[model samples]
Target: MLNQANHDTDDAAPLDMLEAYFAAHGWEHSRSDEEIVASVKGSWTTYELRALWREEDGVLQLLAFPDIKVTDDRRAGVYEAIGLVNEQLWLGHFELWSSSGTLLYRHAALVDGGEEAELSLSAAELIVDSAVDECERFYPVFQFVLWGGKSPKEALAAALIETQGEA
Candidate 1:
């Protein structure tokens, strides 16, 4: 458990806690008034994670970009694959930004103001970790659809296959 005392200051902004967590873990990150952008390395790729603190709605939103680019021809397949991937996710959902064709995972935590307004460091860690984990897990599915020329259903099925012991 993180020592809540260190984050109990009344003047602390939500992003402050996140910045602290990133610094403590030695993650390379930059912070603004309402957002923190961090680079997290995972098994498949390094993700660009952005955490935004919306004070008005008391929401902390996280977006993790896997740095995948979906060309116009592959948009339909990627969209279909996103739908299939989202169904397996119990936490965040994957989205393809239409204009940029960037695939990202998004999740949000509602902190609600007052006594519980402050976001805990552990919670911050979990949010970031979950996004990165999902991105890595489903990265191959997207690859199969976009470049391997596999249909959404076929891509999902192939990506979900698990083998027993290492060869």
Candidate 2:
């Protein structure tokens, strides 16, 4: 008879399972005792995603950063656009580092109450997929704000356009 106490220790830690999942998917990644770092290439941004296990918070957070450096003059417009962009996001929201002008998207998947023990590779894949999708969809808006000098409304409008034609 297998004791529940014994079974608990024998199970792989949630973070370990996540690392293995990334490896099996052929994603370039490295793991530490605290977090997993991976790079995902998107349509407009190559994101450096950090997966952190917030034990106290009972959630696994994936943060993806686009490589756009906002300059001093464009901070107001960028902040304004992010405010509007975040309002429409379903899963995660974009954030800007005011001190460094770095833009990042953050999403969390809850794994509380021993949920991590049963975490599946498919679930991990889906979380990462969502992060990548958000990055791809919004990178152009950042470009439009910083480079194209578009207003918050215009930048978002241009970014949210749907295309249905052959390349």
Candidate 3:
């Protein structure tokens, strides 16, 4: 029997557990046996992320591909700057898809030791939210590298500086 209280579905499968979690939060989503895909609109771009339920590893892998794809000439610069950005992020990391030159954000959450019902909402929330937030926050740094001809260090510096309210 499944714990109906924690999950929206009557069954307690891993995929159902995740689907129910997202649905509870009123997030628009689609799910299959292997993965759940959700669309999130970030500050700079709209992205679609997929969360795959890895039953064998007891991991939920989440990934988001940003709208901007690096051109052939700028791949080296984008690749270098992403390393700097990845260093600062606590959860999830950005990478350029080598074949397509598309920027992607990736993360994973572990749920191996415990039962599916033990999976808290916050864990799922953290994985997805962090990916979305990072995508929105660092997108411009990549743009600066591509268009402005800014060095990785310079772009990163500008991205990290906080702005104050107008006097």
Candidate 4:
């Protein structure tokens, strides 16, 4: 559920509200008519976040790209890793751009009342935060596959190992 505090009640566009949210958080972002691109630093890497609002479909899509680039040789392993990682995610799924071999997290939300409804600021925050959190959590798995030469299952297992107490 979205918080009601910053609900859009005026003529402000959804992306406009999102721009304000990004500004309030001091996130470096640029906004156009329907899209906003922001840079957010995660635990493992800096992520490029792109948000696109489609007014006709009442859908807002968010994509987070990690700093790592997948080469042709690593594509197969990365694809398998993405499947394993996506299975454990609830909000968004990881995708590899076939042409560029770039990995990204993608998620979409629908405005309840179609054209009559607006996306809340809290909702936007939730989407962005969730993507970053998931990226941070699973970043190591991709590395394991690409750099460590580990299988998808092995990479997932290694990344999921829980550590106890403070280091």
Q: TM-scores, in order shown?
A: 0.88, 0.84, 0.83, 0.89
Ranking by lDDT: 1, 4, 2, 3
RMSD of candidates 1 onward, in order? 2.9, 5.9, 4.1, 2.8
lDDT string, candidate 3, 1-167, tens digits = 22356655443555666676667656679988788887766678778878887777788788988888888989988988999999999988898888888888898777765445335555666676788888888988988898887999899998888999987
lDDT winner among the candidates? Answer: 1
List the pairs of residues colliding in candidate 2.
none
Query: Order of candidates by TM-score, top first?
Result: 4, 1, 2, 3
After superposing all C-alphas onto the true structure, candidate 4 shows an RMSD in angstroms of 2.8
Question: In model 4, where do residues sit more than 4 Å from their true spots?
Answer: 1-12, 113-116
Q: Candidate 1 residues 18-54, lDDT tens each?
A: 7887776678999988899999888888899899988
| Steric collisions counted per model | 0, 0, 0, 0
- For model 4 the local lDDT of residue 93 reads 95
Mark the regions of model 2 whose C-alpha exceeds 4 Å error after superposition: 1-12, 114-118
Greater-lDDT candidate between 1 and 4: 1
lDDT tens per residue, model 2, 55-101: 77677888988887888889899899899889988888999898898
Q: Which 10 consecutive positions of candidate 3 have the poorest summed lDDT?
A: 1-10
Indicate the residue-level lDDT of 149 in model 1: 82
Supply candidate 4's per-residue lDDT for 18: 74
Q: Which regions of candidate 1 fall more than 4 Å away from where they truly are?
A: 1-13, 114-116
Model 3: colliding residue pairs = none
